[model samples]
Target: MEISKNIRESKKNILLLANKKNKGHIPSAFSIINFVYLFYENKLNINNDFILSKGHGCLALYSVLEHFNYITTEVFFSFGDFDSILGGHPHLRKNNEIKASTGSLGHGLPIAVGKALAAKINQSSKKIFCLIGDGEANEGTTWESAILADNLKLNNLICIVDNNQSQNRSIPTPNLQKKFSSFGWDVITIDGHNSNEILSVFNLNTINPLCVIMNTKKGKGIADMESNFQEWHHKGITDNLLKLYIKEIHEEAIS
Candidate 1:
């Protein structure tokens, strides 16, 4: 499949910003890049809400929004600078595109459930889309939110887990599909990097809330960081490594 120019450009920009700031969850951010890209590009409906529950992955969200002019290059590069609106984790007021302030694991899904319930009570057509990390799923609050969402039959709520499987701790629930299905959710597991399969899930019509398990690599594009290397979760990018990454990404874009 042809990679979109916007995706290619945004990814390059994201890496450059990471190098400049010298701090970011680059692995976590890269893992979810495709999810954010496809959602805004194809699955998002106007007035619908989105939350990057895994706040460390905000770079991916920021890059996608910046690609569409929702944010500026100045603000994007200002990430992690003292008092910058953009921080390591997402801040709601940072930009109009960001729906919730999240960095704490397990907070996003609950917030999304609340939004979905509120929309349902108001009889609005809006849907709430939230992206969580497989690591974040280890939190108890995540399961609580999942149960509540299903109990209330919040069909408008869509929770997607970026199952990169690179979390620092042992996975609390190994069988994600069975866990969600046991909670009365309509679960779909797909290759997180595949745009086609990711886009196809949006067409699914189900009575229960949707839970998509997106299997993805931790540091997807860069060969050195492609797996769950704990260090890559948040590491400084040296000048040489940055050049190498840029070269690899550009070559991959063309090939």
Candidate 2:
């Protein structure tokens, strides 16, 4: 669980940076932390491509990259600053490790499909992994990409839905597994925070593209924030709240 420890540390840093910069997608970011963590720690293989389709969750991705030494603490702390390249959303130029620059909802899947198709045409064995938020799924482009992925039989394409059940207005999403299954995807539903279940989906072998619907809480790992997810969706952290987050992470790190 060293990766989990690293993630906790990264979250603490992200909060501190957010407090300094006065901007962050805290709830969205925390929700997908475990998904991103397990993807890099246990699922990512050589030449594999990963797309953060849920661009608002970039803080989690940024923190994970920093944890892996792809970015420095100085660069991470500069997030959202006027002169910094790192914004609320991820930019590929800011960090080459990011496969795609995404902030517009529903675009990541199509891009991932294209990448998967290119690998298919070249007969390359690279797999394309894209993480989409349940809210992002509201876009028609997502469904279109899903259909295209199934039509192309892009077995190398894997789409993970971070079904946190809280969208722009805190509205709940539909049954993602049923929706994806209807589109001919090999769908799997699991607790998003569980690393073992998340890792197991990577082992699935099928002719169609894979879709993992991860049922997750919007603000996981932090108690007060967890219940007040809508409020913290894109809220800035205060110094007092930052202290509490640091304390919570530290407690979890040891427990």
Going through the candidates in the order shown, the clash numbers are: 0, 0
lDDT for each residue of candidate 2 in 77-186, tens digit (9 for 90 to 100): 88888887778888878767788889999989999999999999999989999999998888999999989999999999999899887774655568788888999999
Can you list the residue pairs that collide in candidate 1? none
Q: Which runs in model 1 stand beyond 4 Å of their true positions?
A: 43-45, 253-255
Residue 65's lDDT within candidate 1 is: 81
TM-scores of the candidates are: 0.94, 0.94
Candidate 1 CA-lDDT value: 0.84
Tell me model 2's lDDT, rounded to 2 decimals. 0.84
Candidate 1 residues 24-111, lDDT tens each?
8888987888879878887384578889999999889988887767777887888888978888898898777889999988899999
Query: Local distance difference test, per candidate?
Result: 0.84, 0.84
